[model samples]
Target: MAYELTDKDLLDLATGAALLGTGGGGDPLIGRLLVEQALADGCKVRVLDPDELDDDMLVIASAMMGAPTVVLEKVPSGREAVAALRRLEDHLGRQADAVIPMECGGLNSMIPLLVAARADLPVVDGDGMGRAFPELQMETFGVYGVPASPLAIADERGHTAIVATGADNHRTEWFARALTIRMGGSAYIAEYPMTGAQVKRTAIPRTLRLALTLGRTLREAKQEHRDPFDALIDALKQTPYEHGQVLFSGKVTDVSRHVSDGFTQGHALIHGLDSTGTMRIEFRNENLLATVDDRVVAIVPDLITLLDADTATPVTTETLRYGMRVRVFGISTPPIMRTAAALDVFGPAAFGLTQPWQPLEEIAN
Candidate 1:
């Protein structure tokens, strides 16, 4: 069933999206505010089921690209996505029947809501990546050979660029990143225009609803004096996620972070408080690897998320601070991300870790 998203649901939506972000999706704080303001200004947004679309309907996925830290500082003009969407439709010479999030984390998840609202289109309750990922081509759409071409990049200053990716999807990310860097480290993008039939086949369906359910579970767990962490695990397991485990509970001990090749690259060390061992996590704009006592606990493609041990609020990679208490969780990626081809793009080695790609389930065993 389709539902209208009112102002009251923004907080939970952002909270849940941030949890699924796995430590990188830009801040949902920013996303929530955008949606909230849009609602306050009286824009009605509706979340629609992917199945509601005609197979021939046109859809486009959109997101903001660049470091989350950068976007936090340079707030968008609020018109960037609509401008990009307009340019994209002009480039394609057809109207987009709907808008969808490129990924279901932090800013990306909510950005589509704004886009769909401004464009007067329905926001699909699905995304390319069921969770957050760093780059444009890391989505299931890219994995399934959906080209990111006729891509539209726009910024707060009204500058828009149309990029043509003829045969290579990697170049799509490279170009978008370059443009975003020049646009002062953040820009809105609209790409991967696909027919409704393609969307049904390749997209992770009902992810926004999933985020909402996860968020509601967390909130209810806390309200009823239940374990929110266990609630989170249960919510995920009941969904297509299927497997989730509490990887560690600790306090931040040390962090090594720096910007390299346009990404926030770093590692964090967490000292065990209850688990009795040190844990290490690595990232590139997103948490990619987690290790405990020199043993790999989780790697890329599978999610390594950290939450405030007490409140269960998500703690992102950029926000990891010394002395903060945290509980880490390892959840299995969707089946779309575990395939040999997907692994080749996002596995441990793709991030330069020499360790072989191992499932978190196997690692737990």
Candidate 2:
């Protein structure tokens, strides 16, 4: 089924994207504002289900690549996103049949929508990464053998570059990262151009809907003066992520974070409210590992999100600070994302940890 987005839906979607972002993917507020402006300008965007697409349809992924900290200060002009999309379309010698998000987290989730509205094209209701990852090559599309090249990158200043040299995905990341740093540390990208059949085969399905639903669930729970965590985990039960469990509830005792190699990398220490457990979380744009009392509680490809305990708002790495009360939880990734092939691209080892990727449920048990 196809549906058009309303003004309020953007709000909920942004909120949900932030949670799904797992402390990375740029800021959701920026995405929300851009989409809000598009809607205000009377650009009606429709979201088409993957099944609605013909096998021959052309769908391209739109995203922002850079250090999350930099994007916060040097906000995009929105033109960059459109420029990236247009550049890619020109290179392909065909207008995109639909726009899709590289990841359904934070700003990436909304960029495709913004590009779709601006280009007068429909946006697909799915994404390559069901949640955000720091690097371009980590998406399921790449994991499933979709080439990342023919990628178009554009900056806030309207400067654009294309990676069409037939580089492998890792080299593609290197080229794009170099371009992003030179373009003032952040960029909008349109890449992984794929046929509808490839999308159905590789993209995680219905993640846009999940992002919207998550926002709505938390918002409605708050309105009713209910516990948003309970509401949120319950909401997860109905999605591809399945049920999530709170791993620790505590106050942030310390945070060590910095931007390294075009990525935000760091760790945080949280002391349990009951003073019994201490949670240490390590991250690279997105949370990658979590340990309590030196025992691994959660690790990469699984979702480790920090939420404001009282309000249940998702906290990104950029905003984490000492003395904040929070609840941390881990949710399973989609099965496609947990496969051995997928793990080779984004598992703990990929992030410099030796622990092998295991089912989140298995670790929880």
Candidate 3:
């Protein structure tokens, strides 16, 4: 079935995207609002199933690749994202017939909709990562040996560069990080040009539907005065790993952020309101680890979500600050991400942690 973009769909899209993000994707609000604005402006965002594409159709995955904090302070001029895609297309000497989101989490999920609307192309109903990861090379495309280089990065200041490198995925990430730092800490990137067959082989299928469903479930649960967390838990039950503990329920008491090596590294401390104790979260653009009383409760590939304790609305790591009451929840990682290939791309060492990768289920239990 064809997925039509609508305001009602944003809620599910955000929720499902967050779940898929596995703790990275930044916050979804800005992207959600941007998509809403685009739709309001009469931009039609159409979702095409992966199978609908011709084998030879050239498609590029596009998204904002930088510090989420930077995105908030320097709101996009609204042209750089699509411009980046176009620049890549120009460099590649091929017109992109469709656009796919690199992932479905938070900002990434909604970004393709906006890009597609502006570029007048169909947004694929799938993504490279069913969820989100921090680096440019963490997508399923990378896992499948798709190079992230020979890509495009465009800034709001009208500066654009077509970055081509011979490095592997991790090295490509390092290069992009350096460039993003020089570009004032954030830029729009378009990479991983692939055919439909390649997409089908590497990308996570039906992620768009999952987003829509998660969003819709959250909305309906709210309208009916049901527990949104429970609803989210139910939706994610079919995925790998077990549901973890509710780490904390409190307001953000502190946030520390700095841009280094082209990534935003930060920590957020939340003081509990209910019985849940104080929780500290460390992030690199996207939330990476959550600890309560110095005990690791959640890690990447598993999800660590911040929601308004009362309203159950998501709060971005960038926007999290003093006195914002939030309920912290956790979910397990997908099987694909738990694999050795996936870990090499996003494991503990990949994020600078010396400890080994441990699924949240084990830690929580």
Candidate 4:
């Protein structure tokens, strides 16, 4: 049976989703506001387990794809996201029975809630990537050989494109990125059509509940005047991977950004409070690598999270800026991200470096 979501649930979902975002998902604040508005206007978000989906039911994954920075500067028209989904449905000749979060982190989690409330469809309580990733092909959808093509991309300006291709997911990622750049560096996308069975087999199950639990833990910890990071670390320790370490706690001193090949490329320098060295972070709409004193400390696949030093709130790649005090935390990557195939696809070399990939746990330990 499907479940109904309350405001309390939304809070928890955001918390857990941020932890999983691995430092790349956009901020959940705006998304949470959108959902809150919807709820106030009498929109109720319904959630369903993967088992509740019918075999013949059509399902679509939706998310905002772009520079998380740009998303903040140019607020969404609110309709563009769901409009993209509807356009995809029109092209597919079927209505999506359930909407699923493309990734379980930050804004992506809340996005589906808004989409479900607006579309009046039930949202599957699962996600493609249990965490956030930089590209379209980073999710389990790609691991499962699900194609992201025939995707519908829509902008706040009402520009829309339905791209179809027979190429691989990498090619699809390149194409969608081009379209997104053409649409001013950000757009709402709906792709990866799958059945309930496909969803059940490929998705990170019970993610919504996980998100809620994480969020609630943070909230309750704050209410009790406890260390929020302690709560987060505790919750994460329950998961499979090792919780590496807390490298630094400090304020952002500089953010250098520019457009490179139609993508946002940048680096942030964070001033440390408890350490003698400064932390430098490089990103491509996601934190890709972190270094201290010119030594690489953490890299992608293994999670590198930035949080408000005081409140423990997550800071997205786009929102990272000068003068923002933050804490840096590392978690080992899941086994999938460490695979040879996955590394070739997303490692430093894939991002244009000739350097060999090193596990975060190794460096931190």
Candidate 5:
């Protein structure tokens, strides 16, 4: 089924995308406004399942790359993704058939919608990462050997740089991050141009709908005065992410944050209210590791999301603070991300942790 996004769906989409962001992916507030404005202007943006396209059709991914803080300070002009897409098409000497999100995080999840509306293309219902990851190369597309170039990165001022060659996705990330820092700490990007077959194979299918569905479930639960955590898990049960489980419920006791290597680096401590333990979460843009009093509970490639204990609102990494009552949930990544090859790129090892990869289901048990 095709879903056409209008102004009304903005809040739900943004809220749900933030939840899936797993404490990173930048805030969705600004991106939400951009998509809302585009929809209000009558720009047609429809979400299509990747399977709806032909195996040979062309599609490209679009997203914002930079410090979440910088993105907030330097709001997008909404032309960066469009500009990058056009440049990529020009390089390929062909028009794209559709647009897909590079990641299913807060800002990124909505970015392709804006680009699709502007480019007059439909946005696919799937994304590279089931959730968000801090780095460009951490996406499922990259994990499956999709090249990250010929890529384009553009700033609000209309300045753009095209990377015609990237040795690998890692090099693409390095170059893009460097250029973004020079482009005033943030820029919109169009990269990983791939075929529909590649998308269907590597992308997490129907994640856009998953995010919105989870958000709607939580919202309805709140209105009905039910346990939103139960609603969230029930929602996940109907999707590919059936491993969702609440790991801890508590109030944040401490937060430590600073910018390291142009990425938000931080850790949050949640003191359990009823569980008699503390949950510590470390992050570099996205939550990479979570532990209970120094024993590993959840690590990278497994989704670790924090939500308000009462309303179930998502608490982004940048907004987490002392004394906020929250519940933390762990959701397993899609099956594609659990392979040995995918783990090497996005596993606990990728985050420089010594622990081995453990499925969230195993940890939950």
Candidate 6:
């Protein structure tokens, strides 16, 4: 069923998207605020099922690209993403019929809603990454054969660029990264033009709603004096993520992170709240690996996230600091994302991890 997102729903949506972001995707706070501001200005965003699309309807996935930390300081104008979409349309010679999110985690999930509301177009319920990933090529659209350009990019200042490098999504990333870095480490983009049929066949389904469900579940759990972690784990059993389990619970002891080549790259250590063992988590914008006691418990392209130990609020990678209590959890990726072909693009190796990709279920056991 199709539904319209009201202002009341934004907070839950942001909360869940941040969790699904797996410690990347800019900040959901920024994303929610942008959507709220747009709604206050009288814009209404409607979400449509991918099945509602005509076979030929044109769809564009819109997103923000750059370091999560940079987005916190350099917020978008809420107009740049629409501009990028328009620029892409001009280059493609056809206006978009609908907007879909490039990824469902974090800030990018809401980016499509903002663009759709401002442009008076509906948004597809699905997305490329069921969870957020750091780079453009990591999306299932790219993994499954969608070309990422003639992609369009825009900065807060109104500059727009069209990047086209044939079928090489990787080369597209190189050019886009350099362009984004020059744009002050953050920018809005529209890419992966697809027909409705293609979208239906390729996109991760219903993750926007999944994020909303997660947030609502956690919030209600807390309100009802239930355990948010248990509630969260139960919620995943009913979603595409399939399952989630706690990996560790402790306080951040040390964080070693730095921004380099347009990514927040580094790791953090968490000391047990009731034990002496320490768990280490690594990242490149998104949480990539979770290690404890020299064992690789979770690795990308699985979903690993840190939440506030008590509140279950997601903790983004850039904000991790020494002494904050955090709970680490890992969830399985959708089957499409775990296929051998998908691993070639976003597996641990894709992120330069030496370990082979294993199911989060297998690793947990």
Best by lDDT: 6
TM-score, structure 6 vs. true: 0.99
Once superposed on the true structure, which residue ranges of model 6 sit more than 4 Å away at CA? none
Per-candidate TM-scores read: 0.97, 0.98, 0.91, 0.91, 0.97, 0.99
**What lDDT tens digits, residue by residue, belong to model 4 across residues 11-111?**
77776778677656677878888998888889999999998888877889989888776777877756888999999999999999989999888788888
Off by over 4 Å in 1: none
What is the total number of backbone clashes in candidate 3?
Answer: 7
lDDT (0 to 1) per candidate = 0.86, 0.90, 0.79, 0.80, 0.87, 0.92
Clashes of each: 0, 0, 7, 1, 0, 0
**Least accurate stretch of 10 residues (summed lDDT) in model 3?**
238-247
**Per-residue lDDT of candidate 6, residues 57-85 (tens digit):** 99999999999999989978799999999
Give the runs in model 2 whose Cα sits over 4 Å from its true position: none
lDDT of 3: 0.79
lDDT of 5 by residue, 65-94 (tens): 987877878888888889999888888899
| lDDT score, candidate 3, position 193 | 88
Point to the candidate with the largest TM-score. Answer: 6
Name model 5 segments beyond 4 Å from true. none
Ranking by lDDT: 6, 2, 5, 1, 4, 3
Cα RMSD (Å) per model?
1.3, 1.0, 2.4, 2.3, 1.3, 0.8
